[model samples]
Target: MDWLLNADTNGEKFLVMLAAVGLFVVVMGAVLVAVDRPRWVPQWLVVLGFIGPAVLMLVFGLVYPGLRTAYESFFDRNGENFIGFDNYVRVFTQDEFQIVLRNTAIWVLLVPVAATFIGLVYAVLVDRTRFEAAAKALIFLPMAISMVGASIIWKFIYEYKPDQPGVNQIGLANQVLVWLGLEPYQFVITAPWNTFFLIVVMIWIQAGFAMTVLSAAIKAIPDDIIEAARLDGVGGVRMFRYVTIPVIRPALVVVVTTIAITTLKVFDIVRTMTGGQFSTSVVANEFYTQAFTRFNFGLGASMAVLLFVLVIPIVVYNIRQMRLSEDIR
Candidate 1:
C-alpha cells in the first residue's frame, strides 16, 4: 500500500497501474459471474451488476466535483468565509469580467456560424469532385493538430515585427500585409480585435470538424430527393439553399451546438496566444486565471459554474434536435 501510494519511480508507477487494472478485472469478473447466474440472481441485481460501477464512477467523478465547485463559488478567495453571490455579481458588474463575458459570447456566436458555414460550403463544393479527398484532407489537417499546437502554429502566422529597412516580417499574415505595402499590425497584443484574431484560430480548427460532419450529412441526403429537386429545375445555389440545407438541418444543428460548446470552453488558444492578457480573456481562461493563477477560488469556481450553466442549454438543445431528426427519419 505504501509502495502504491508513494510511486516515485517509473517502474513503481507501472506496477501501481497494473495493480489497479488487476483489481478492476477481478471486480468486473466477480460482477460478471454474479450476472451470469441469472437463474439464481434477481434481474435487478444482475442489471445493477452491469451498470453499478458506471453509476458510481459518474457520481464520484462528475456529480461530486460539479456540486463541490458550485458550493465553493459562494465562498471567498481563500474558500474559508461565506460570500454568497459576490463573485457572480463581480463577474457581471466588473468591466474586466464584462469584457470576458462579451468575448465568450462573441466566440460562441461567431465560431459555430462561421465554421459551420464555411464547412458546409466547402463540403458542398468538394463533394464528389475529382479532388474531394485531397481537399478534405487539407482542410481537416488542422483538426488533427492539438489546440495548443494549432495556437502555436497560428501564433507564428500572426507574428508581427517592426517595418525597418532590414527587418523582415516572418509571419504569413504580416508578410501579406507588407506585400500590400501596409504596416505590420499587432495581432495578439492589441485589444478588441485581438479577440477576433484568436477566434479565427478556433474557426480554422473547427471548420474541419464541421466539414466532416456536414459532409456526411450532405452525402446521406436521399438520392431520390436530390433527383426530384433537379427535375424541378432546382439547380446551383437554389438547390443548395433549398434541398441541401433542409436535409442536413439536423447535422447543422449538431455541428453548430458542438462548436458553440467547444468555443465556450476555449482556453488553450487564448492562453497560448495571449495568456488572456489585453482584454482577451473568456470564461474558461478567466476561471484558470482566477482559481489557479490568482488564488481566487470563489471567483474561479463561479466562472466554471457560469460556463457549465451556459453549456447545459446547448447540450439539451443538441440532444433534442438529434431526437427530433431521428424521429423524422
Candidate 2:
C-alpha cells in the first residue's frame, strides 16, 4: 500500500500495475483453458472470454474518461483545491459571460426559424418546377463545405478595408454597397450586427437541410387530398395556407428543433472567423476559450454542462414531436 502511494507512481502507475495483473490473469486462464484437458469448462466461459475484452475497453475508454472530466469540473485547472459552484456563478455574473449567453440566445432564436422558413419557402416554390433539382442542389452546396471552410469564404465576403486611394474592395457585400454609392462597412468588426453576420454562415448551410426535409414532407401529402381541395375551389395562396402548412407542420417542427440543437452547439464558425472577439462569443466558443486558452478548466466544464442542460430539453421535445408525428401518420 505504501509503495502504491509513493510519489514515483502518483497513483496512476499503481492502477496500471493492477490492470496489467488482471489482464495477465485473464490471458493465462484463457491459455490454460485452450491447452489443458478441461472437460468441465462450459460454453458460457468462452462467451465471457469474448465479452471481457469489449467490457474492459468500454470501461477504460468511455466510462473512465467521462467520469474523470465530470470530476475535474469540480477542481481547479491544476486539478487541485475544490471550488464548487463559483465557476457557475462566474458564468452568469461576468459581463463577458452575459454577452456569451445573450449571443447564444440570439443565435438559438434567429438561425433556426429564419433558415427553416427560407428553406420551406424555397422548397414549396420550386416543388413542381423545371429547375427544382438545380435550385435545391445549388442551395445545398454550402452544407458540403466544412465549418472552417465556410467561415473563410464568408470572411472574404465580409472583408473590410478602410477607404484609401485606389483600393478596390474585394468583399462582395462591400462591393455591392460601393456600387449603390454607399460607404463600405467593416462587417466582421461591427458589434451587435456582426453576430448576425456570423449567423448568416450557419443559416446558409442549414437552410438547405430544412428545405430538403420540408420538400419531402410536401411531396408526401396525398394527391387525393390535393384533387379534393381543387374540386372545392381551393387554390393558390388560400390552398397553400389552409392545406399545405397544416400537413407539413410535423416536418417544420423537426427542422426548427434540429436547427436549434445545432445552433446551441455552434463553435467552429465563431472560432474560425472571429476567435471569440468583439462581443461575438457564444457558449460553445466561450467554453473553448475558458478551458483551453485561459486554463480555467472548472469554468469551462461548467459552461459545457450548462450547454448540455440547455440542449437536452430541446432534443427530448424533438423526439416527442417526431413520435407524435409518426403516430399521426
Candidate 3:
C-alpha cells in the first residue's frame, strides 16, 4: 500500500492507473458472473452487484470525505491536537471571517434573486419574438464562458484607472462614470459596493441559465389556460401574473435554488476579480484561503464543514420543493 502511494516516476504512475482500471474491470467481471449465474447466487446478490459498487464509491468518495472533514474540524491546526468548537467559533466570531460569512450571505441572497428575476423577465419578453433564438443566445452567451474567463471579461469591463491628467480610462464602468462628468471609481478596491459589483458579474453569467429553464417552463403552460385567460379580457400583466407565473412557479423555485447553490459555491469570480480582498471574501474563497494559503487544516476543515452545513439546508429545501411541486402536479 505504501509503495502504491509512492509512485514518483511516470512509469509508476502509469502502472498505478493501469492497476486501478484492471481492478475495476475485475470487479465488474465478478459482478457480471454472479448476476449471470443467478440460480447459484441469490436475487439480492444480483441487485447488489448492480448497485453495490456505486454505493461503495459514494461511501468512499463523498460520505467518507465529508465525515472525515467533520471530524478534522474538531481538531487543531495540524490535525494532531484536539480543539473542539474553537475553529467554528472563530469562523463566526472573528471579524474577518464574519465578513466572509456576510459576503457569502449577500452573494446567496442577491445573485439568485437578481439572476432569476432578470432571466424570468428576459425569457418572458423574448418568448415568441421575431429574433427569439438570437435574443436568448445573447443572454445565454455568458453561461458558456468559463467562470475564470467570465471574471477576466468582467474585470476589464469594471477596470479602473486613477483620475489623472492625460490618463485614459480603460474600464467601461469608469468610462461611463467619466462620460457622466464623474471621476473614475475604483470598483474592486471599495468595500460592500465592490462585493455588489462582483455579484453583478455572477448575475450576468447565471441569468441566461435561468432564462433557458424558465423559458421552457413558460412555453409548457397549457394553451387552453392562456386562451381562457385572454377570452376573459385577462391580457398582459394580468395574464402573466395569473397564468404564466403560477404555472411556472415550480420552475422558478428550481431556478432560484439552483442559482443559490451555484452562487454559494462560487470561488473563481471573487478570486479573479478582487482576490477576496477589500472585504469581499466569501466562505468558499475563505475556505481556500485557509486550507491552501494559510495551511491551517483545522480551520480549513471547519470552514469546509460550515459550508457543508449551510448547503445541506438549501439542498433539503430544494428537494422538498421539488417533491411538493411534483405532488401538486
| Candidate 2 lDDT by residue in tens digits, 255-314 | 999999999998999999999999999999999999899998888888888888899899
Off by over 4 Å in 1: 1-13, 319-329
lDDT of 1 by residue, 136-214 (tens): 9999999889999999999999999998999999999999999998999999988889999999999999999999999
TM-scores of the models, in the order given = 0.92, 0.82, 0.89
Q: Give the number of the best model, judged by lDDT.
A: 1
Q: Whole-model lDDT, candidate 3? A: 0.92
Model 3 lDDT, residue 194, Cα = 93
- Model 3 Cα lDDT, one tens digit per residue, 1-329: 65478988898899999998999899899889878985787889888989999999999999999899999999998999999899999998998988998999999999999999999999999989899999999999998899999989988988988999999999999999999999998888888799999998999999999999999999899899988988999999888898899999989999998999888889999999988889999999999999999899999999888888888888899999889989987
**Evaluation by lDDT, superior candidate among 1 and 2:** 1
lDDT of 2: 0.89
List lDDT for all candidates, in order: 0.95, 0.89, 0.92
How would you order the candidates by TM-score, starting with the best? 1, 3, 2
Model 3 Cα shift for residue 295 (angstroms):
1.2
User: What are the runs in model 3 whose C-alpha is more than 4 Å off?
Assistant: 1-45
